[model samples]
Target: MVTDRFNSLGRPARLVALCLLVVAVAFLVLGRWDLALAIGAGALLGWVLLKPVRITWAIFAVAFMVPVTIDLGYPTNPSYTLLLVLFVLAGWGRLHRAERDGWPPRRIGAALLLPFCAVLAGVLHWHGVKPVVVGVAPLLCIGVLGWHLIEEARRDPKLILRIAEVFTWVSVAVAALAKYQTLTGTWPLFDQFAYDWTYTSVFDPTRAAGFFGHPIVYGSFAMAMALVSLTIRGRYWYVPFTANLIGLVLSGTRSAWVGTALALGIWLLLNVRKIAWRGVATGVIITVVAFAAVAVNPSTFRIGTSEPPPTWVSPTEPGTKPSPSPSTSSVDSVGVAGARMSDPVGSASASARFERIAVAWDGITRDWSTVIFGNGPESSVRYLEDVGIGDGQAQVFDNTYLTIWHNFGLVGLLSLLGLLLALFWRSRSLAGRLIIVGFAAQIFFFDVWLWLSAVGVLLLAVALGAAEDRPWPTLPFLNGLRKRRPRAPETSDASTPGFAAAA
Candidate 1:
């Protein structure tokens, strides 16, 4: 009976069955029997469909359905691995097709090197089993995904833009959910344990975590998306740009706000030549409308003045006694009630970021190895551990450039800078330049260099490089001037006395 059943199933059907079996096993291992059953059913249906495009789309959907972020008692999450896998699969397909066609290998070689470099960096930092499995592997995955998208999918700029749009929408939804949780005094959907560490809001009374582990991270992500949206020309472009801007403001992340503003400024400057008059008119209209709105509603977009609990309170401490709940009058006295607070234009947060930058610089200077090669991936945490700095109390290196230099050493830092410089120089269109500049602006105050948020922008920058019209400089040996023969001296049309005689 087993031999007959084996004979009944053809090779393709058997392959499908094997994949289904693997999915079932994975689901069983993860204790998700329902998901396993669904996958099993989907596999059978997908085989019946027999359309390659449909099957591919179904696989993509299933891959995305898998939750990338699972709590494994670690600060880092593996949610992004799913994206990396999808990109790798897509890249592999492209590569296989290219190989079959006997395409020139040099083009593919250049395309693959960036990701290889990133993988090399990851491998060099790999220490034990945990580091290899968790940190380095995940980073390599991201690098491969970035390279795949930039090199393969870049022919369709619209597709890349659509992905950015989707990410923006997702971020908005997450931010809204977070705000809802904050208002209802409920735990956030993600990062439940870190709820108390969130800053309290006064007027709005909400924390803004938009699908990210932290509010600031979400805000920075939104800001980058906003910049990208602004680069696109469309009727609905302003909607995302405005929403993302508002979301960033509500995030109460001072560094993000500053970074966004600076990025926007750079974007505006880059696009000024093309849209100078329209931009001026738009700016004037927005300013006038904003002033009118503020005049009519003084409380709109007011900054919160809620004071943080005393340092001794230990809000995030497990099993710590809660402080005595304050009365309404006490809350009122502390400026927590309906008192409108003026926005502190460039507040203490900005000052604190500057201080952190200085501290990171000082720390890097103290260690020669850190200054040269970087401490290694996520080495700042280890470095802090060596210096007896607790994770909770550790000072953040807010600047991405500083963070990169401190962690990856000079080689990694310069490689990143070179990549950025190449993108900037290669940017031909105004929109492309704006996108690159916007990302560059954020490097001063956020550890964006390591995050997928920045990686996406970097990938987009690389893709834009392909669309640029700039020509490669001629080599000294290949110069046209060097190849051209000297022209013979031209004779006068009307022969002069001596020349005519010689003629």
Candidate 2:
């Protein structure tokens, strides 16, 4: 009876469900956690209330807009909460539907191993397991989420474009916030939540962090929006696309710039035939003009100086002999020994990143167990402290690959690579391709998913993956091309008497 009720629930039932969800969210935000929980429970009890497709749309749209939470410091974004609710409704819908659900892709098992290993390593290393669990939980949820979204997409191929349009609007909202900060000299989202939102302007602040915690994260978010905008066509399309590009520039993160550049280039290459030649030429001309002007007068443009700053070394002790300055050849070296690749060449931040990598690499290679299984989840902090770097509480290897390499070693690295490849391989639709490219570009800058704001990004990819026409791919060795159905045989003219007589 319950299944039958939900199967045929009409507009009035959906309206009631919508009202209940709104109240539940309002109650939660107002700190009435009990009331929110009760209302949510009541909505569920009415089995016929929730509409799966409409709820799916709300989950994404709200997730992008409402990264807010009941508390600070926790993963307070409610996208995760909405996702769990959606999954419940989806399961119920499937049980009473005409078609049976299929099993998820094989690659998920391999992907899930990363978390399992994290938990096991935590137990063995004697570190508290809670942090490890929290760190990997979102990843695990998104893993299954991709499969479910793909299933939904198969039923309605248009969902991917609709989701892309949703993302374009989300990107515009965030970009407007970033621009507003420039005008008002205050960022409401961060300031409202009492976050230490840095980045005063293009000159004073380190970078424009926007609603997201870090400028790099915001850049990634903007880059995602830009890619989605380019892929989807509709009214006022250029607004969000241009806004996201401007926001990316304000982010001032080199890695994000590189990622966005690469994704944009790839998108252009993939759709070169369809792109307008005049627009491309105009973009090229404007870019050249901008570059030439910046080159002519760096000071006028407020860009960096032509001369490099002097290298910073610790002052010699009062009575001790001073060290000789290194020659020109050695100046290029960065990192701890002052000997890594040139990034900002002689700057402090560049030195810190490479030094963290060199130090992190050294810490993990000390023994076979440490090297193979890694020191455990979130174990990088302890190692950093042990190595005598700023009390080890703050300094971290921001590089995701390096961090995973240091934490989970070769196996983890390989598993991560496999997942990335699998996701790329399975992206059949153009929109899905754009989402994957945008997300992959951002991750090189930071573990963007670590923050609440980025959950929508991952969810978008999941939704895109859901809409992909390709079947769940196996190992990357197998080609991702979907097999075509055979064409029906054509009836000959002789088979039709009217046609034959006319001839």
Candidate 3:
């Protein structure tokens, strides 16, 4: 009777406990050790209620609201660190009670392990312990959370849909904030960072960033979640989807626009067999509404939307093209970063990308060992620092595959590809695969696979889910321990008869 009653109220108690824990931890990390102890006590007292789903929502909140690394000496971000600890602890609470379901086969496990092993090898061979930990901690932490979510999903097939709904609500909140920022020109959370300072625009109000550090991540993630919204069940799905699309356009990220369109086009083609007419109509309506919003608020939303592609011109010299005019290269600014300007030569967006590719190729070929094991991230940084480009050094290769190839060598790059292909094999949803496709394309434009980029978490979670993690029981500290029964004694006569096989 007591167990039954406790079970009835367990969920709510847990939710409260989880909230207290986050507050406590946030305070503690911020140096309020006294308040931390108090709130932590509340969480410990209500331990039974901490659920994986609840913890995940909390993680989502932290990821969106405080994506930046807290003002700590360590490179780890507060959200990443807190989410890692809280998620693992909360998930540990139920692991012993769950049942095994849809676990991956040995071959698939081996396939996934390949990429990790490659990275580990790189860590050991190139980067020392401390540097590697600082470099790879966020990715590892998020990957662990992904596996945790997968385990929970195995116990309940509906978990994926529920997660999708959570993602939609988060997107809705971000969209609302984006609209507010659009109107005010100042982001409430960013503290005096007016829209003009961070985002580009043709009018007073510029491209929006929701709650993210950059407009690019905000738009990309919104579009990705918009895709997720369509896959979920609900008549109101269109609402969030439209809102995210509006946010996406308001971001004014050209790469995002192209990448999202490509992903949606792929999703539509593959889902043609199973998709409903309502879903199709709803997608059309969402697209139309988003574009309509762009049309309605030309002053607020227009950035690169009205500009036509730059025309290709003949070289003025033997092998040199004319530099972009000041109008093309520079925008007026009255902010701290000052008037930002794109480089007209080597650092120019178009020229810089090609220059980076050349630099990456040169770095990898500098030594034979680097081609096999690849250059380390630290070494890559060092190499870029030495190789003078413009006034600054080039740190990125401007391509995801190139970055991976430069870091992990041919073996690691191949393993990474295998892992990605295997993830696609395990994934059942076309939309899920489409998300992968979108990021794969976007990486060519910018390297987002590292650290806490939106795609970083999304890719890991979706991939782990597709891998079909097995659920396990998370036992209580002492009460859930298995008890052994005593063995029964055998008769001496039966033992004697069997000793010599006497028949």
Best by lDDT: 2
TM-score of each: 0.62, 0.67, 0.66
Report residue 275 deviation for candidate 2 (angstroms). 5.9
Weakest ten-residue segment in model 3 by summed lDDT: 329-338
Predicted structure 2, TM vs. truth:
0.67
* CA lDDT of every candidate: 0.50, 0.57, 0.55
lDDT, candidate 3, 280-383, per-residue tens: 79668777877665445323356755532222333577634233222221111112112122322333465777878888888777677778777754455556
Which residues of candidate 1, in runs, are more than 4 Å off? 1-76, 79-87, 90-94, 100-139, 165-188, 191-206, 271-359, 366-370, 388-396, 464-503
Worst 10 residues of 2 by lDDT: 328-337
| Local error of candidate 2 at residue 75 (angstroms) | 9.7
Candidate 1 residue lDDT tens string, 1-503: 96688568789878877877887999899998767876775565545345323323333243322323233332344444444434555455456445544444554554444444434444655644453244345445444444544444334555544555565565556545544543343324443433333323221233444445455555656666676666654456655665566556545555565666776666555344466677779666655543332122122344774443322233466754343224211111112211222444354545566566666777677666657755556556555555632333325566777766766667766766776665565454334455566567666766653454444555555544444333323224444553484543487433222211221
- How do the candidates rank by TM-score, highest first? 2, 3, 1
Number of clashes in every candidate structure?
Answer: 6, 3, 8
Q: In model 1, which range of ten residues has the least summed lDDT?
A: 329-338
